[model samples]
Structure formats: structure tokens, C-alpha cells
Target chain A: MAHDIDTLSGTEVSRTSMPEEKRSDHALIEATKSGDEAAFGEIMDRYRSPITNYLYRFLNDYEEAVDLAQETFVRVYFAIDRYHTQFAFSTYIYRIATNLAISEIRRRKRRRLMSLTGLFQSEEDTQVEFQPPDTRKLQDTELVEDERSQIIARAIAALPEKYRIPVILRDIEGRSYDEIAEIMQLGLGTTKSRINRGRGLLKEKLQHYL
Target chain B: MSDEDLQNNEPVSRLLGELKHVEAPSDFDFGVRARIAAGRPAEKGGFRIPVWLAYGAPLALVLAVGGYFALNSFYSVGDANVPVVALNEKANVAAPIPAPSREVVSAPPVTKPDDQLVVKKPDVVSDSNVVAVKKPIAKDKNAGGGSIDLASRVGRRFHATPQIPAKTVLDLIGAKGSFEADGWRVQSTTPNSLAERSQIQTGDVIESVNGQTVTDKSTLRSNTPLKTVRVRRDGKSVDIVIKN
Candidate 1:
């Protein structure tokens, strides 16, 4: 069934009684258009980490993830004139981030394939993985935590793009199936099935850890 | 990733229940905000001024003022006896000799800076004369057009000052997540850090530090570098050298 965004957002217009902290994302976005910079700041404050973390899971590199996340918001700010308030702001932000991540992955793949020296590199070394430069030393507890994170990250990275994207959005970021479907621009049933298949693949990789 | 969140007794969900939340760096919002503000077009008012005007007006004004002075000077040079002098700035030459006049007048020899065209228009009516007149056509590297001088920060000692490691301890506070069930694993090593110098790699399971098994958490201490570490990398036990 098609979502009646006009009806839903119209209902949200009556939410002015809510406190500043309790104001909806739609309200914040609308506020941004009327020359309210603080409203835009609030929007960034709310979504920056979620979007950054989502991109981090997708790209595996925190720096690139942060960069893309910032780019996403920059695009949002510049194009606020064109953005219709009818849609959910969360869905809009996530869709922008998802597109950026997928585009970057394709770009990196093209760059890697075009490099002459890369032809001589080992297949394992050439695999695109999220391995950020981390030099900080940790004790046992933190070490164990870090180790688990790396294993999970690697397993997710190993998943094929079709499965990896949905899996990361579902498990790591906890995005709903409907939102993932909208972001991925797929049928609702297909999104659920892919998430399930992705979970099965993740289970195989993570069986030993559990 | 809780089993309930998945809406069934799913084993994968149970295992993924402890999945770590990715925290954006504290500076994340600060950066995004700066970009947003920097990218924001100045709010459009009732009247929208063309963007080119912001830059073009000042440039046009400068050219207008410069052209006015140039034209004024060009018209003021009324003497037909004076010859135009073309000075090759790249080459050095002595004071250019003037064409002889009917009356031999003794005046102090005026020296002008290089690249300056001295159009010595001798005053026929009075003793005074214009010496070393500027042509204003620039030929030097300092000619202010499209050229950009790159200021490089290479090898300036104050700039070369080594960055203090933000990390307070030598103890690895970073990703320790690549380990197997029993031993500490090396996920990665930064290019010039102690880990890379010690020959650690992604799958290297650190078995011992200073010949002592890693079962002891105190094996790593602040500022006390380890020596003779052993790693089980690629199905073989190898000694890793740690240079302080």
C-alpha cells in the first residue's frame, strides 16, 4: 500500500505543543527552510552519528564514512529548496547515505581494476576491507571487545553487496525492513527475504564465535 | 540484534545481540556543521543580486581608476622631441642617452629602477624635466595575473615538529578483535607505528610478549616496550622484533 505522506505530515503539523527536544524530524527540517540555522544544526545533531555509523558499516572506513556522511548533509542543505516535506526525513537521509556508499564502492572497484600494479597484488590483499589506521593499545577487556568488532566487521565485509548492505542496515544499524526497502528501492517482500538470507550467511561466518 | 527484535528465536540474532554500536567521533557533527554553513548560499532576500557582481564590481572599479590615470598621463605627454624608450627588464643597461638639444644644459644624471622606462621629456620652456617615467606594463614574475605562488610546508622545523601521539600508553587500545578463541590477534598495523615495525599483520595471533604468554594482561605496560614477541601467523610460530 502506498504511504500517504501528505496525510501523515499534515498530522505532524499539530505537534507544536511538543518541547524542542521532542520536536519531530519533519518539524526540524521545515524549520531549516525558514532561515533557522539552529533548526538545521538540530537536524545534523540528531542524524550525523546515525548516518556516519551507517556509512561506516557500509564502507568499513570511519574517515570515508564521516566524509560521505558530511557530503550527504551538504547535499541536503543545498537542495533543501527542492526537498518536499511530505516524506519521512529519516528515510530521506538514509537513502542519500545508501546511494553515496554504493557509488563509492563502485568507484573504488573501478580504481582498483584500472591500476596496473594492482594486477600483481595478491587477491586477498586486494580485497576491499574496512581496515582503518588504529594505533591505540588496549588492555584485555577492551582487547576482547575490539577483537569481536573486527571479526564481525570482516564477516559483514565478506558478504556479497546484495546481502551485505541489507544485513548491515538491519543488524548493525537496526533499520526497519520498510525503511530498508525504501532506501534500497526494492519490494517489501524482497527486502525481508534478502535480510533473512543475509542473516543466514552471517550465521555461517559467526557460528564459531557464538 | 536481540532475538525479540528479529521476532523469532533466531540463532543469528542471538549471536548478533552483542554487536557493537559504531560511535561517530565527537568531531563528526562539528565537521558536518562547518560544511553545511560553508556550503550554505547566503539567504536570498526580496532582491537577489547576481553572484558575478560581488567579484566583478571591485575589479571593474580598479580597472576604471587605473585606466583614468593611464589616459591622463598619456594625453599629458605633449612633447614631440622625446623618443619612447623600451627597456628589456631581463638585461642590465646604463642610463639611456637623450637626443641632443640646441642648448647644452647641465642637469644631475637621474638613475631609475630596473624595468622602468625613463622618457626624458626635456622642458623646452623651463630647466625642470620629467625623468624616469613609469610605463606600468609589467613583465616580471610579480605581475599580478593568474599565477599562484605555492607556499609549501616542507622541512620547516617548527612545522616538522613531531606530533605527540594522542595515545597515552603503549598498550594497544585499538582493534583487538581479530583474535581467535584463545590468543590475542593483530588485526592491522599502521604504516610507521611500533606494530608495523614489529612485523605484525591482520591474522597474526600474538602468542607471547617478551617470551611470556599473553594470559597475563599486565604483559603490556605504559612506555615499557616489549621485546622478542612471538606470533602464530599463517600456521607457523615466528619471532617479531619490537623496536622502541
Candidate 2:
């Protein structure tokens, strides 16, 4: 198990501990390209949780987030040959995940537009459909935490997609502004502007929590 | 401070950062592996058709059917334009010379005296020779002199008046005659006509024109210019070349 600190943003680019393999993302991708299925599985193990979390915050639905995260890995696996190493693997994977999330959001909008239940409700109502069913009992503290989490999730989801993506990547995913710009295919100034606008919007909604 | 510094230090960013991170489900790796093993979704059912081909195939079929029928109707109209004979009481058989605005009467095929000269109608007719005939109408004796009424009366009389040795192929090709059974017995020729210029006299019986034997049912193609007239004169068949 080896660890590498990413200098640009102080995030961990390496796994916390894995006894069998500790290859870098580029090395693992090259191994996957050479028909190493285990290398691809390791790559999936490294990024899946973070990608799933990012999508969950973006969509405010756990099930859809998991589904899109899996789809992201599948897309990366099949299109690995076309993947250029000029961009970081994280940027490439995040971009794939972002596009998939946006597409899922649009699909949900179209479905809601056509459904009777969705016709009269505000855009906030779109979050309910793909929510993973939680049947387990919750203690008082956990319940309180869950309620606050839902409010924060809803506030983030309510932001317009342009602002939502950059805000989620910056604050929640801890991606640097340069990386966010690369993932969004936007200029640095525009990415910073959108992140500020998103924070302004979130500040109004989460004033109590702040 | 700059917007970037404010965005970085914002309390909203801290709150968002403090929120709980959602992890992928425990079976997530298994699910992805299973999906990869299954390959891309089976195209709904084994195969997929192109959207253009699906819609275009039916559209092309409709166009083909419509075009075939449209072309068929046009050919039918062209077939109707061909000259056909009208039946008469006497052996006076020839294509009906039409009156204006009248329905053309086409006859059943008539047998000729010389069976070799089939009396069936010609498949092509010149625009000048194309005529339409209608069933004869009773003349209105008390009709006033209005142009429409006058035309109706004239057409009625023209049909009612009995034909003498009826108009023959010779009549269509600039030779007006009371065509007898033997040949076209020349009644009269207009000045500078093919008959008159060919030296065909009133009494001379035309046996053939351009080597085709003349009969009551025999027809000369109106589109073709008359070349020579074979007439029986003084107990001899003489072929006379007609100048154009």
C-alpha cells in the first residue's frame, strides 16, 4: 500500500492501502489496455466511491448516482483505447461522469414532463423518483443529521446545472479550479464566476447551517 | 478580496464540504463486472433498424404505387386518342369524324371483303384527323338562332342526314368521295387537292393508293403524304404519281 499526495490540490491520488497492487492511474490504464482485467477492477475500486458521491450530490438521488457511476466505469473500460494521457485520469473520468449525470438529469426532466404526477410540481419534486428506499430505523441524532443533509442536498440540486456542476466539483469533490475548468471545458474565469454564483445561491438557502 | 478568494473562503463552501459523502453500494463492483460480462445491451431484441430506412421504406412503397397508377392513367388517355371506326347501316365503315364537344363513338372490329386488309383502327392519328363522334341527336326544328342552339341544330342535322357511300380513308387524306365497294369512285376533288393533281377524274375508280388496295373498310394513314394513286381508267389500272 503506497500513498501519493497530489500537490495542485491536496487530495489523495493513490489508494489508502491495498496489499496486492499499488500502480498509478496511468500505469493501471496502460495495464488495462494490455488486457489486465485486475488493473481495471483496481481503477474502479479507487474512483467509484468519490464518483458516486459527486453524482449523488449533483442529482440528490442515491440510486441514480450509483447507476451513473457504474456507467462511467463501463464507458471508460470500452473507450480506454481512445483515452489520451494528455489529461489526468481523474479529469477524464470526472468529465465522463459529469456528462452522464447531465444526460440523466435531462432524461428525468423529459420523463417528468410526460408524467401526470410531475406536471404540477416544481423542479424540486424531481429528486424523489430515483431516491434509494431507506427502510431502516434511525436514532434521534442520525435522523437530525439526515434531515439537515437532505436540506443541503436539495439546495445544491436546486442550483441551475451550470452553477451546480462547478460548485459540487469545487466544494464537495475538492477539485481545483483548473481541474474544474478542464472537466467543464470552460475558461478559468468562467469556472470561478460560476462557482461564486453557486456559493451565493447556496448561502441564501443554507444560511441556518452556515 | 478577489471573487476567487471569497469563493474559496465562503461559509457556504465550508457547509457543503462538511456535508456527509455518499459512497457507492457494497455490490457496486459486482454490478459493473456483471454488466461488462453481459456486453452492450442487446439492442432491445438482437438487431436495430435505422430510423431513415424504417420510415423511408414505407414512404418509397407508397410513392412507387402512386407513380405506377399515375403513369397507367396517362397511358390510358393516350390509348383513347387512337382513331377507331364507327359502325354504319351500309358497308360504309371508317373512323368517326368528330363534331365539336361530342363524345367519340368507337365501333367493334369490322371484317373486310379482302380479309388481308384488316379493318381495325390505326393506333396513331394526326391531330388534324382526330375527331370525336357522338350518338345522333334529334334536330330541334324550333330552335332560335343563338350560337349554342345553332351549333346543336347543325350537329343534329349532320348526324341525321344519311351518309352516301360513307366517307372513306380517301376522304381523310384530301379525297372526298361516295366510296363504293370496288374502290373509291371519285365524286369530286377540291382545287389543287392530291386527287385533282394526281389527274384522278370524277368517273375514275381508285383501286389503290401507294400500293395498298382500297376497300370500303380500307384506311389511308392521314399523317402520311399521298405518293401515287392507282386508278382503273378505260379498262386499265394506271398508277399516277401525285406531286407534293
Candidate 3:
């Protein structure tokens, strides 16, 4: 029975990988553009987690990041006709995600300007939703792994946009310098420099806890 | 620099690695896939209601109304200033009546056809003979032969006005809007055209034309007058001539 279960899971994994790995992003994109909604859903399912994580770091808000990630994929779905295969599909999607994040940031800034209390309201709402129970009890109850993860997320959220983006893409998303350069629309040299700088900044910011 | 320093930084790298594995919400994939499905090309496609029309319809209506008033102000002379002359050939009478510098300001009072000779000089041009005359005729013939109607002349002037030129670059990859890239350059003007004549450089970044903001190279090319181009060159704004 154990062997059968293993075989079933392995077969499922292989079945999912078969279509995705065999078909290039370009092929999926072409299919999506031609009105194959399933093709786009497949693309989204493949990249959604990384895109969401990237946006979460950029926005520092889970709900907003999720919304933006959804928006990014939606935009990608419509704009597949314009997607060129010159760069990796990952680079293309990251570029779209980054642009959306920037626009969201700008929009938040505008909203903040319109109403001073608006900024605090969003934070209050997030806290209401994501706040833990009483500190001492929470600490006692929380798993070590979960606590460590939460601390890491908070540290990431503290970094500036320029540093945070490159660091998140390089370290978190596991993207290479060339891919990062294409996504950020910066030169390779600049991309490497930014990544190094981002890491250094993150180290400096989080040195106390570590 | 040193192995000690590198070792100290290892925790940061490890933490970053841990952060990489941060699990997104369970429904994230489902939500994004749904959105992607929604954004997919409609199975049946043709010219749809423009996105801008939905957003800008109110602003467009307001502008259309304002534009009508502004145009009317430029062309409309007060009705009182219109000249009125009455010729009663049937009455066997003609008056070198003072061409009332002002036509009757009020609508004509009720009057019989024979009594319509009452040319209420400055108030109304009650011509018993002609009905529905709404324009001023040039009394000075030498100004232009056969009394060129001023209203008609203005109408022709407005009618002959050229439309603003524009071009659109669709199906672009990498770039979002028109001027999203530094190296994304466009040469819009034809050689020796009005744009060229005005010394509008081919590679110049068009910022605006006639107070209208241009967001992309296509907008700059199409909306900018070939005769006048406002461009940003070497970090300075300048207007150059382009021959139409």
C-alpha cells in the first residue's frame, strides 16, 4: 500500500510536470492568447507562489500582494501577444510583477497624501487580521519554526524598495544575475551590484537578531 | 574580506533562504489562475467599448460642453451688433434708413405683413419679405466681391481646420506605455516635412504640444503639430518648428 501511494504521488507529479516542462512558456503564452483560458491558468498555477512572494516583500501586505499577483497574471494573460521569447519567461513575469508593485506603491502614496489617517487605517486593519494572541502566551505556544519565519518576514519588510526587490529576487526567488537584470531592466553589472548591496543592507538591518 | 566576516554573514544568507520558502496563502494560485482566466482573450473578439470611454465618459462630456461654449465665444458676435436693412419694394418704398448699428434685441412683436415695414431699427431687423435670415452680410462690397458672408467665412475657416495627427504603437513587448524606455526612440517626422522644417530633432523627447500632455512616442508623433513641436532636449524644454 505504501509503495502504491508513492507511485500514485510520483505519477501525479510527473503528469503535472510533463505538460509544463515539455511545453515552453511561449507555447503556453500562444495558447493563452488564442483564448485557451486553461493554458493561462496552468501558467498562473506554475508561477503564482513566487510572484506572490515577490509582491508580498514589495508591498509588505499579504492581501495587497496577493491581489497584485493576481493582477500581474491577469495583465500577463492579456499581454501575452507582446511577450517576446528573447528573455526567460521568469524574467518577463517578474518584470510585470515589479511594475505592478511600483504602481501600487505610488497609488498608496497618493492615497496617503489625500488622507493622513488612511495609512494608519490600513495598518490597523492588517494588525486586526494578522495579530497574534497575548505576547507571552503566543511566544509559549508558537512553534520555533513559525517564530523564526515571522521574524525573517518582518526583517524583510523593513528593507527599502531598491534593496528589498533585488535581494528578494536573488535570494528568495533564486533568480540569477542575468535574469534579475532583464526583469529589473538594469544592466547585468548593475544587477549584481544591487544584489550585493541589498544583501549587505539586509545583513546590517538584521544583524542584531542573527 | 576575512573568513570570520564571511561566517558572520552566513546567518543572513540562511535567513534569506528560509524566507524564500515562505508559503503563500493556499488560495493564491487559485485566485491568480481565476484572474488569468478572466483576462484571457474573449472567445469572440472585435472592437469592444474602449477602456478609456468607460473611465473618461464624464470628463469627455464636460469637455465637449466647455468646448462648445469656448468656440461659440470666439465666433458669436452679439445679435444686437448685426446690421438690418428693410426693402419694401411692394410698398414702392425704400429707406436709406440708418443701418441700425444694432439689430432689434428683442424678438419681433406680432405685426401684419403690410405693417411689417416697421423696421424696429436697432432692436430687430423685421424684414417683412425675408424670413429666417440669421447672418450679417458685408455691406462693403470692395472688402470682397458679392458680399462674402462673415458667418460663412468663419464656418469655412473652422471647417477647413486640419485634424491633429496621431500614431499608435500596439503589440509592444517589454515597454508598458509610450515612453517607458530611455533607448526606446522614435523618428516620427517625415524627411523635409513640417516637423523637420521646424528643426524638431528626430530623437528629441516630445514632452507636450499645445498644453496637451503626451505620454508616449506615438502620442507625441500623432498629436504634435508637424509645424510646432515642444520637446525636451539635453534636459531643457524648447519649442521648435515643424513644417506641416
> Candidate 2 docking category?
acceptable
Q: What do the candidate models score in CA lDDT, each in turn? A: 0.55, 0.64, 0.52
lDDT of 1 by residue, B1-244 (tens): 4435355426775555466655666787677678666766322132533546644665698799999999665543422211121111211222222335233122323335563222222222111112221232222212211100000011122222211111111222221334356566666554434455456776777676566555322212211223466788789999976542
Candidate 2: Cα lDDT at A172: 95
**Where does candidate 2 clash, by residue pair?**
B98-B132, B104-B133
Candidate 1: stretches off by over 4 Å: A1-21, A117-145, B1-9, B40-244
Error of 3 at B207 (Å): 73
Which candidate, 1 or 3, has the higher lDDT? 1
Provide DockQ values for all models, in the order shown. 0.19, 0.30, 0.23
Candidate with the greatest DockQ versus the true structure = 2
Instruction: Give the per-residue lDDT of model 3 (tens digit) for B1-244.
Output: 3446545556776778776343456676676566555756222123433446643675687789999999866554333222211111221123223333334222233334432222122222222111122332222211111101232223245443211112111101001123534322335443332244456565666654454444432221111112333677777878754321
Return the lDDT, model 3, position A192.
68
- The C-alpha RMSD in Å for every predicted model, in order, reads 34.7, 18.9, 26.3
Candidate 3 Cα errors over 4 Å, as ranges: A1-21, A117-145, B1-10, B24-244
TM-score of each: 0.45, 0.48, 0.43
Best by lDDT: 2
- How many collisions per candidate? 9, 2, 14
Better of 2 and 3 by lDDT: 2
DockQ leaderboard ranking? 2, 3, 1
